[model samples]
Target: MARWEPHARQRLADAALELFAERGYEETTVLDIARRAGLAKSTFFRHFQDKRGVLFAEDAPAGPLVAAIAAAPAQAGPLDAVEYGLDALGRDVFTADRRPFTLRRRAVIEAHPDLREREALKEAGLTAAMGRAIAGRGVPGLAARVTAELGGLALKAAYERWSDPAGTEDFGDIARQTLDEIRSAVAEVRG
Candidate 1:
């Protein structure tokens, strides 16, 4: 086995994204990504299962965001907890420097139907994960499920806005704004 190199996964992900953007996701091969990363094919396999896996690797933000939600103050409501989690993730994971790479990745995923399906599945998984996490905090099952679904919607909306080139707001701000919009919509429907 090749000696494990620190930041190897990130290096491969960066290279893969760059290649995916330049040559298109379908045109880029694993070997091309490995070569760009200055690593062997085996190294690429060790980090990611395949070319698509490189785009959907374990570095997903959902896990940490769920953990943050679980750690929110006990007095916080479900949406409040979700907002806290989004803020935590935005601060810790989606830093300003990562915006360009994120936009590029989104563009690649958007251009490909298969990748879009994968992205939807990933979002569903995140919703389920968030639901489970919220339920674990003693929230009722139905309420937790609804809250999680709403949070997922807010996250998607926020991410879409954040990925826009002309958008100036950060992820956390966008997420909060989206969540508020959701709340207002729900209230209007109830009234």
Candidate 2:
């Protein structure tokens, strides 16, 4: 049996990312990550199911996004509610200090097809959860689904821009701007 180690999860994640970047994802083994983190292999299993899980375990829950949406003003439109969720993500998850790690993680995922597929599935799950949250606010199903999809697009775009080494804007600000751009594009398409 393995006992809980302080900061074990974060240590393992950092070590895994470093290993993935250095040795390539396919070449990095779970035992290697455990050794890098100075934790027993059981500790790695305690935190994540596998090596790929190390990158994604922290985001396994959509709770923060859904909570932010639920906390939005009652009068807010579906997209506005979704924006609130994105803002929360910026404030809580994708802070400026995490940008470097995010860039490395994105690169690792992009380099591997399996990880890319998992990332896509994760995004789809997140969007589905967001749509459900919107519908809970009394939005129509179609409208909720549309808002969720648009929000997903905005999130991806904002993340890309924010991850740029030269970008200095906060994640929340970039996300709001990206959502606005998405809205404008949709309106133009409707014309």
Candidate 3:
């Protein structure tokens, strides 16, 4: 067992991602990840429920983003609140320092069909959470659902842009731009 050290969760995550990249996600086991992290298997279990959990842990983004949405100013409309939430998540959770890890994780996820399905489920969960938050803010059910779905779509677009190696824009800027594009597309459909 490696010495009880700080950043154990981060170490486990880093090790998991590296191992998943090196050996493929399907072949990488929790024990392999723990060994690579210089930690015990128990330590891995302490931080994550399973190998997949290593990638989709509670600290990932969903909860924090939802909380941010819930905490947005009451006066803000549903879409504005979503933008605020995305901004908060971009600034606080998905900082530039995490970009490399995010890219690597995305690569691993995209390489696997099962992981892709799980990723879709995770995004759907986020959308549902956002819808609930918007509804809690006194928005009508259908409008809240639509706004949240649009926000989710914008988030996916922004994340793709942010993850692009050639892209230079900040996440918040990309998110806002994506939202604007979504709004414009909707306007075009309505006209």
Number of the top-ranking candidate, with lDDT as the measure: 2
How do all models score by TM-score? 0.88, 0.92, 0.92
Question: Against the unseen true structure, what C-alpha lDDT does each candidate score?
Answer: 0.88, 0.88, 0.87
Give candidate 2 misplaced runs (Cα > 4 Å): 1-5
Candidate 3: worst-modelled 10 consecutive residues by lDDT: 55-64
Where does candidate 3 stray beyond 4 Å? Answer: 58-60
Per-structure clash totals for the candidates = 0, 0, 0
Q: For model 1, what is the alpha-carbon lDDT of residue 95?
A: 76
RMSD of each: 2.4, 2.1, 1.7
Local accuracy of candidate 1 as per-residue lDDT tens digits, 77-162: 99999999899778987778778778878988999999999999999998998899899889998999999999999888888999
- In model 1, where do residues sit more than 4 Å from their true spots? 1-8
lDDT of 1 at 9: 85
lDDT of 3 by residue, 17-119 (tens): 9999888998989989988988889988888899999778735677678788888888988999999889987888778888887888899999999999999
Worst lDDT window (10 residues) for model 2? 52-61
Query: With candidate 1 superimposed using the best TM-score fit, by how many Å does residue 158's alpha carbon deviate from the native?
Result: 1.0
* Global Cα lDDT for candidate 1: 0.88
